[model samples]
Target chain A: MARPDNARYQETHEWGRLEKDGTVTIGITDFAVDQLNDLTFVDLPEKGDKVTRGEAFGEIESVKAVSDLISPVSGKIVAVNDGVDGDDFSALKKDAFGAGWLIKVKPDNAKELDKAKSLADYEKQLAEEAH
Target chain B: MQETPLRAEHERLGARMVDFAGWYMPVTYTNIMEEHRRVRTKVGLFDVSHMGRYWFSGRDHIKFIDKLVTNDRAGMKPGQIRYSLMLNGQGGALDDVLVYGAGDDATMLVVNAGNRPKIWDWIQRQRKGFVVDVTDMSTDYAMIALQGPESANLLNKVSEVDTKALKYYRFTRGTVFGEPEVLVSRTGYTGEDGFELIMPQAKAAYFWRELLNVGESLGAGPAGLGARDTLRLEAGMPLYGHELEEHINPLEAGLDWAVKLEKEDFIGKDATVAIKAKGLEHRLVGLNIAGKRIPRQGQDVLRDGKKVGTIASGTKSPWLDEIIATAFVPANMAEVGMSFQLEFPGKGTRTMKPEEMRQTALVVPMPFYKRPGKK
Candidate 1:
């Protein structure tokens, strides 16, 4: 799927979207999910946990390897996605952008999202990586 | 990086290639779980050309081989294959190998890809008094494994050799897909019935494509090394660097059956006998953890809050959907139903207590998933 046009992305393939209520919704991109094929477990932070920008807040384990889920913006996690947290991964596998949002964070500073790449820039980075 | 004969075919199939033991090989075509299940229930093809294949001949072929490996070669019938471990003088394993007894004058030794150079040098150094001609034919042939429950049916459809007549651990030369002189062996690392075919390197691409073409209707597909590892782990097979290491003897690794102590003195025979007499300090045991988080290699195994063992190999089994692992613990603690704690790497120094980072691991029987109705 085309990365949602409004979402800001990190080089590590995480995407975050800013809402009118000033909370940011975060989830991993399709590319990251594809690379981590056959995911067996996903460990996410609980609600009210503090997350720092450009640091690992959780982990994702596939059949072969384990990778970190980096945060794009520092914030306190206000809500965790119960739909994709535990043994069930149907939401994350079905629509990674829409229903698969991992956490909702109330950012320390909304301007921190400015450091992330735009949708076009993220696609450009992905294109260059293909070569 | 070294390339296999079927490298181009793997690329065409959209395989995710990675550097494995200095050779560029496919890790997965689609996904590891899908390929793993395919091998368990149906059939899957694997390009194992990267492994070292050495052909031996001459007057002392059997004598030289019998003196180098742990398994008995004197009683091996023609066309039979035996799994053996080549060891150092200290009884430490050099490499686990498959000894193929072709005939009175010929033998073939297949070694792991990573240990090819070391094994080759060891053989050369050890053959001072024996008259054996060893030829390294790893690059000259392509080894393909057709594995699963439906493998025999698939082989009978494409090859002239009658799959029904081939007994387990036996090999035969036959024509496959109009390609003559193909060596078809009914042996595999997977716990299911399967065949490993050795063919000329030049015709590897043709045979790979043809096999998929004909076997596709029988639910056959291409698998990669990722699936190969999980399948072998579930089968309780000892990988070279993991379960069978340079410092780990066959007895400590639960491979006592393959080590023939009564046979004539081979390399490490004296040390092996001494080890048996001294009894085992630590023994390899299987662990079943009750969670999704896998216990990785080198992780600490604990008993009553004290570190006592280490994980050798572990995976979230695709077939059983459970976290199965192999570990080495004190021989007294290796019994089934014995429980221990597996210390997982804590997440970012957020330690609550010792018990928080540890998960309970139970000692279980090996070969966690056995193919039903097969020996």
Candidate 2:
């Protein structure tokens, strides 16, 4: 899947999109979902939880492995995606960008996302990893 | 890392390759769940050439083997295969192996991939006075496992061998794809009735493609190590590094049947007898967790907020659709109906209390998903 140009990505494969309300939506990239195939369970932080940039906030468990869900920006989580955290994962499996957003955080500083990689830069990193 | 004979074939199939036991092997073709389901319901092929294969010959072959392994190999009929464990002097399991009684003079042993080097060295050191010639045929021969309920039908359609006549744990030499000297055995790690084929390394790719071509309509496709692990775990088979280790004995691993104490003077017989007489301190037990959280290896098994044991192996069983695991707990707590807690550490850097992050685990019967019509 082509990454959205408006969003910024983390080297760990997380994406953060800034909304008009100054809150940033967070979710893992399609490459991450593909790598962690057959997800069995997902653990997300609760609403009002604090998240630090480049830190693990939660975890994602697949059949074969367990990977941490890294935060792209440091902030206070205003909302958590109940749909992804619950038993059903159809929304996360179908669309990881829009419907599969894990958490919405009110950032301490919106400039924290500036350290994230752009779409072109993230794709380049993925390409190099492929080789 | 070492590459198998079918490495190119795996790459062509777009397999997700990983370094397993110092060998470049495929972990999955697509996803583990799909491939695991295919094996349980239909059929699946696996490239298992990385496992060590050794051929034994000479007059004292059986004698040498009987002394090294724990099983009673003296009574094994021709073409019979028996699972056995090789233990150190302290009664700790060195490696679990398969002993193939090819004939009165010739025998074969298949060892785990990770322990190939260690076992090879052990065998060389132990063959001192015995007049047995052991040849490592791992590179010269390639192994493939054809598994599932539809495996027999698929094998019958492609090979000249009458798979229907082959009894469980029995093998036959035949030709596949017009290539001669293929040894087909009715044995597998998975609980399903399947076949393990050993053929020349040079003909591996050709035979693999031919089998897939003929078996495709029978719902046969290549499965990778990921599926193989889940399938075996569901079948309640113990893996080497997880359940069996150099410090873990077969008796504690729930593999007592494979360790024959009645046999005369095996390597670890005295220690095993002592262990049996003194009674077991710890035992391996199957566990079923309450939720979807998987209990990974080395995770603490808690009882009353205290560490009581360690998880040996665990996974979200694809067939059973439950969180099943095996753990080494006190023998007194190894009975069914026993309940414990599996501690899951918080992923965040912040410290959390033990009681805050834990899952309920219950002791349950193993062979979690036995194949239909199997006793």
Candidate 3:
């Protein structure tokens, strides 16, 4: 999945693409969706709500089990992409990079981005996980 | 404690392996929901070799097992099948099983995976005076279940043997995939119409590959124990350990129909009679997700802030799009349309009323999802 150069990934399989405007576009990674099976209901965070790093923002209710969506960065929910709520689950399969985007956040601090994994590092990390 | 012939196949498919009744088995392949949705909408392949099979022979064998099981096996013709239970001396279930009257003296008992040894011993003890030979064919045999609406068509293609004559709960033994020792039974754990194929252990992999190849056009997936649990739960069927055990009687588990009170004799009849006169305390019933989360087995059942019983098996119903569970509730609360509260994560106590009534799960029996008739 393609992303902005400045974005980072969480080891738990969530990705955050930090836009130039200091807002970050967030969604669970492709690996997370596969691990979760068919996505049935995604509870997106309300726009303007606040979430903390490593805390649950909402939940993604898969048919088999429900998993909490954690915020990779502490921030106020600036906007949530309506695509997931719009029922284009094929996005998670087709254009998971762009159209499958979940929520956007204005990070509390720019340096907090350092806590995430780089693209090359995340790929190698996923490789190690594959082994 | 032994794994099925598909252990390597399961691992290759990235199945999440767990110890079920001591046998290391795959609980899921890919994801449970993925497999479950595929089964509901399409077809699913199941490796069911873990179940135990016993063949009974001798003239008295018919009378022997008929007295043991609750089903009216004495009246069954060859190729006919019946679902029944083996009761203990006190009328409690030894195990819920499928009995096939292969011939006048030829009877077969398919038992649960966990209770093979115990049930085998029970059968031996009962055979003290009867002139019969009981052979444990489980180790030598393997079983596969092709479940879902399309399963029948897929299985029919693999074998030229007549299937149109076969109705529900009937069996016919013949060759499948060039293997001569095949028995196709019109039965399954999944609610969908399907067939269970039994073959020798050595020929299992061959049959597996054949089924996958032919069933590919039918949209069959290698379903694991996880999706099997979800599918069976949706059907409101009982799991041996969770929904049934020696400590619990069939009456409480809503298996009273399997108890033949008029039978000349069987284990557990006397106990069941006594218990029936005394009345039942708890009734096993289906509980729709009382809250945001699903109820798991062994979780305490509550009524009026007091403990009543406990949950046995549960899952989030893909069809219902809600958490659903089966629990043992007080006999009174078990009535159709009864309401109760269940504790869930974040959501403390939530009271939800059952949407239906109990009648073969038709009323409040909690089928949870309405389904069309099979092809």
Candidate 4:
């Protein structure tokens, strides 16, 4: 799978990208979506909700299991993707890094992006974990 | 882990395997949703060899089984099949099983895989005064099910058996695929026209591959345990561990039709009689969720804000395109159209609204997706 060049990745498989404004776009990685098999439900945090870094913001359920969606960066939610919360989630599978973005957050600290892994580093981490 | 005769073939087909009841079996050949949809609309083959099979025979075989099971076995004719429950002395279910009468002096039991050893030991301990001998036949034979609307037509193209004439819950010993003698029974867990075939373990793989070859041309493909579960759940079939359990009585589990209360002395008769007189405290009912979120087993069932019961078996119904579940609630509260809330515990946040996390459900009649002519 191709990791997007514009996004910074977290160890827990979430991705965050700095926008033109002070806000950031966040979503789970394609690798995470693949591990979940078929996505049945994506519970997203409400807009204006306060989120802390490395904490769970919502949950995602597959047919067989449920997983927590961990936040990659601490911020205030500026926008939420209502389409992803709807019945069909094929868009999430088809474009994990593009239209599948879960939420937009106004970051508490923009420098937190420095701690996020680059595309190459995230791919390397995934390769190392495969062993 | 134990492997079925078709285990290697499943792996070669790129099936996703999982450990199920000590056996390495295919949970899905491809995607679960696609496989589930295939069985609902077309035909699908399933390898169910992991279930425990046992044979019983002697002068006292019929008498012993009649005394042990909750269903009447004395009136069963040769080649008849009946679904029954074996209960403990407390009227709790031991296991729900299918009793097949091979003859007046012989019978067979097909039981759940996880409870095979326990059921064997329980029956054997009660055989001291009987003349019957119980033999475990699980390894000697392998089984497969061809299920869906097109099952009979698919089988007719490959087998000599008169598939169209076979009645539901009846079996015939006949040759299949021109190979060897096998027992073909018109029975299935999915609410569809189907057949379960039992053959010698040595010939199982050969027949499996042959069936797939012919069946594929007819739009039939190999399904797996994942599809099997969704199909059965949509059909309102009770799974052993989920709906039926050691402490769950058959009466409360909505299996009163299988329990013969007036039959000559049987296990749990006294307890069942007393319970019947007093009426049941709880009853199983089907819940149809209004929206998309699927309720899972062990989730709390509530009325208003108070917990009323717990979910037993639940699934996202591929046929209905909705979420359906089976739960036990107070007998008085189990009427159709009764509303309730399924409370799924939020994992991370205590900040989410209670209404946001819970899904509304209503009680509905069971066998949720029953096919026409499925008695």
Best by TM-score: 2
Rank ordering of all candidates by TM-score, starting from the highest? 2, 1, 4, 3
DockQ per candidate:
0.33, 0.40, 0.12, 0.26
Q: Write the per-residue lDDT of candidate 2 for residues B1-375, one digit (tens) a residue.
A: 898999999999999888899999999999998899889988899999999999999988899999999998888999999999999999999999999998797999999999999999999989999989999999999999999999999888878998878999999899877878799999998788899999999999988888889988998899999998999998989999999998888999999889888888789889989988999988999999977678889999999989999999899888888899999999999999999998777574222334446788999998788999999
Weakest ten-residue segment in model 1 chain B by summed lDDT: B346-355
Ranking by lDDT: 1, 2, 4, 3
lDDT per residue, candidate 1, B1-375, as tens digits?
888999999999999888899899999999999999999999999999999999999999899999999998878999899999999999999999999998897999999999999999999999998989999999999999999998998898888997888899999899998889999999999888999999999999998998899898899999999999999999999999999898899999999999999897799999989988999888999999976678888888999889999999989899988999999999989999999998755343232134545788999998898899866
Q: Write the per-residue lDDT of candidate 3 for residues B191-266, one digit (tens) a residue.
A: 7788999998998887877787888888988898878888888887888988888878888888877778888877
lDDT by residue for model 1 over A1-131, one digit each (tens)?
Answer: 76798999999999999999999999998887877777887777778889999998887778787788889999999988888774577788788899988988999998899899999999999888654
User: What CAPRI class is candidate 4?
Assistant: acceptable
- Per-residue lDDT of B130-198 in model 4, one digit per residue for the tens? 999899999999999999888888888888899777899999888897865799999988888889999
TM-score of each: 0.93, 0.95, 0.75, 0.88
DockQ of 4: 0.26
Q: RMSD to native for every prediction? A: 2.5, 2.3, 5.9, 3.6
lDDT of 4 by residue, A1-131 (tens): 57789889988889999999989899999978876665677777788889888888888887766788877789899998766774457768888898888889999997887788999999999888643
Off by over 4 Å in 4: A2-26, A29-35, A52-54, A72-79, A104-131, B344-356, B373-375
Q: Rank by DockQ, highest first.
A: 2, 1, 4, 3
Candidate 2 Cα errors over 4 Å, as ranges: B345-356
The numbered model that scores best in DockQ is: 2
Worst window of 10 by summed lDDT in candidate 2 chain B: B348-357
For model 2, the docking class works out as acceptable
